[model samples]
Target: MLIFLSLYFLNDIFAFSGSQDLCGYCFDTLVNSFDKRNSILSPSFKNEQHPIFVTWKKKGQLRGCIGTFSPLPLHSGLQEYALISAKRDDRFRPISVSEVPDLDVTVSIMHSFEQASRWDDWKVGVHGIRVSLNDGTSIYSATYLPEVMSELGWNQEQAIESCLQKGGYRGKLNDRIKAQVQVTRYQTSISKMDYQEYIQWRKAKLTSIRGDL
Candidate 1:
């Protein structure tokens, strides 16, 4: 399970209203990092281990996206990857503190991984596919999140072919190469929040805490 970054913007058709708290926690972590603070306001959710991804967008464009397939403790994992994806995704420059106010954050929790029967076995919009290709001496691998297919309007075969190319496969896309591809399919529960929403959520949370106190 390797960490990969995607530049694709999530399709508008899919709605991710799962966990604002999760996205809030990610935003908190990033804001703290930018401010040189070590303290994080505890998240309002239970800590559990899950394979997670953190994605950042600026004005609906991809800023950074990265995550791992390994299950990790939610609190620490979110905190870690929140910064990693925002600042370390090599495809784009590191996100600055100034960018924080304009960014949107998304958190994806991946699960139900199954080995596909064939390269084209996975569903287009339902499953995120990871492809591994071995071209005799070298091995290449990459993954696209579930929304990618629908956003790009690709059928199963096209999605697989795109994934092969994404995995750094430079060889021909003949049947032999396609036949040798190993695919693993997984699904994700996603949550998203924009910077303004984060501020509002934080304000409401603080007000609630104060009232309780």
Candidate 2:
């Protein structure tokens, strides 16, 4: 299991329709990082804060995935995490520039958090879950994004148990442990862009800029 910490706070819900432009910004950030140049594109969205996750895939397989539970300004946060997920995810080696063309990026903006009555109280596909367990010695925490449960075909119990293991809990699983778990459920609006699509978007943006000039 990949190890990543998860934490959140209750806040007023904000409207965000995950946009292709957001994913384009991520791609631009990453390519610039690889080239050791500053990003040439600015995010067009408002600079509102939200809990965001950036996930990278290569040829339909998980290459890297990382994000923050804390709210962060959209522009800087996406810029920061685009590189972090690609270059800093410890589950895999740093993504090389050569691999950029084969990669697809997904940006998930998380919102609508609610405390679950029980570990299984939330809908599987609709909610991303964060689970925390205190076993009288230490607290273990982990999260799965909203798309994860449906993608993996996991029931609520299975997802919770898997999240526990991902959080580095080696203890026995029983009613006692399940009863002790604290669960927070949330949702995300996501946008995905493949490398080719990113390239096309970049070209169109440049064309539009030249036309205006």
Residue-level lDDT of model 1, residues 1-213, one tens digit each, is: 322211121221023338798899899998988675534677877666677899999998899999988777788999999999999999999999898889999898876677888887889889999899988898999998997688789998888888888878777767887789999988788898999999998888888988999
What total of clashing residue pairs does each candidate reach? 0, 0
For candidate 2, give the lDDT of residue 190. 86
lDDT of each: 0.82, 0.85
Model 1, residue 205: distance off in Å is: 1.0
Model 2 lDDT, full chain set: 0.85
Measured against the true structure, the TM-scores of the candidates, in listed sequence, are 0.88, 0.91
Return the TM-score for candidate 1, rounded to 2 decimals: 0.88
Q: What C-alpha root-mean-square deviation, in Å, does candidate 2 show against the real structure?
A: 4.4
lDDT of 1: 0.82
Give the number of the best model, judged by lDDT. 2
Candidate 2 residues lying further than 4 Å off, grouped into runs, are 1-15, 36-38
